[model samples]
Target: MSIYLCISGIVFSVYLIANLWAMSSNRLNQPGYVLTDLDGLVGVRHNSLSRLFSGFTTLVAKQHIRRIQVSSECLTLFTDADDCVNIWLSDRYLPINANYAKVLFPQAEFVDSPFLP
Candidate 1:
């Protein structure tokens, strides 16, 4: 009985250690999206796992972009097809500015509108 208890304790310790390491390394595979600058196009990337498991379903082309609107909460991208993509700004994503817009979408007009969209 003592031997079984010792073995079970060891196994539990190993499991706890593994979980701690995974949490510290952020390998738990959280659901989130990242925007990648693809020169002329903006790629919307989903999933933080291996690229083979991830998907880029939405791609915003530079030439097709009608205008770029920035608000206090988020940045909106208007396309020629009347579709708007909102990229919410946070402290992690950095503050919005004209230089940042130019670097991200150089061809599109950056509109600093008061409207919150």
Candidate 2:
């Protein structure tokens, strides 16, 4: 019916607008750090939505990071015994390679968080 068509058109328009905004904003350009036992990865790009909500709090030191934890949704870098830097990841913007991380931190823990980007 005309009513259904109208609704579908509105939904499509909204989806298109949101996708364009995300692309234009380059939503994964925030600086992040990756840590491993033998080597450290720094200056990685993080999700823009995560940075916007969490803000930058801790500065990770390459020498201090002890472990790296990766999950489907996020990457957590631990340092100084207890400190952690949580970086959210998006499928559209994967700044780091998960396979490379796995090779670097073979014994690292993987956890799932109840958050989405």
| TM-score of each model, paired residue for residue | 0.50, 0.41
Give the per-residue lDDT of model 2 (tens digit) for 17-97: 764564335433322232223245444334443334345333444555567665555677676588776655554443344
lDDT of 1 by residue, 10-116 (tens): 99998777644433332222112345567777664322222123453467787887787767645677888889876544323424333455566667887876654
- What are the clash counts of all predictions, listed in order? 0, 0
Best by TM-score: 1
Pairs that collide in candidate 2 are none
TM-score of 2: 0.41
RMSD of each: 9.5, 9.2
How big is the positional error of residue 13 in model 1, measured in Å on the Cα after superposition? 25
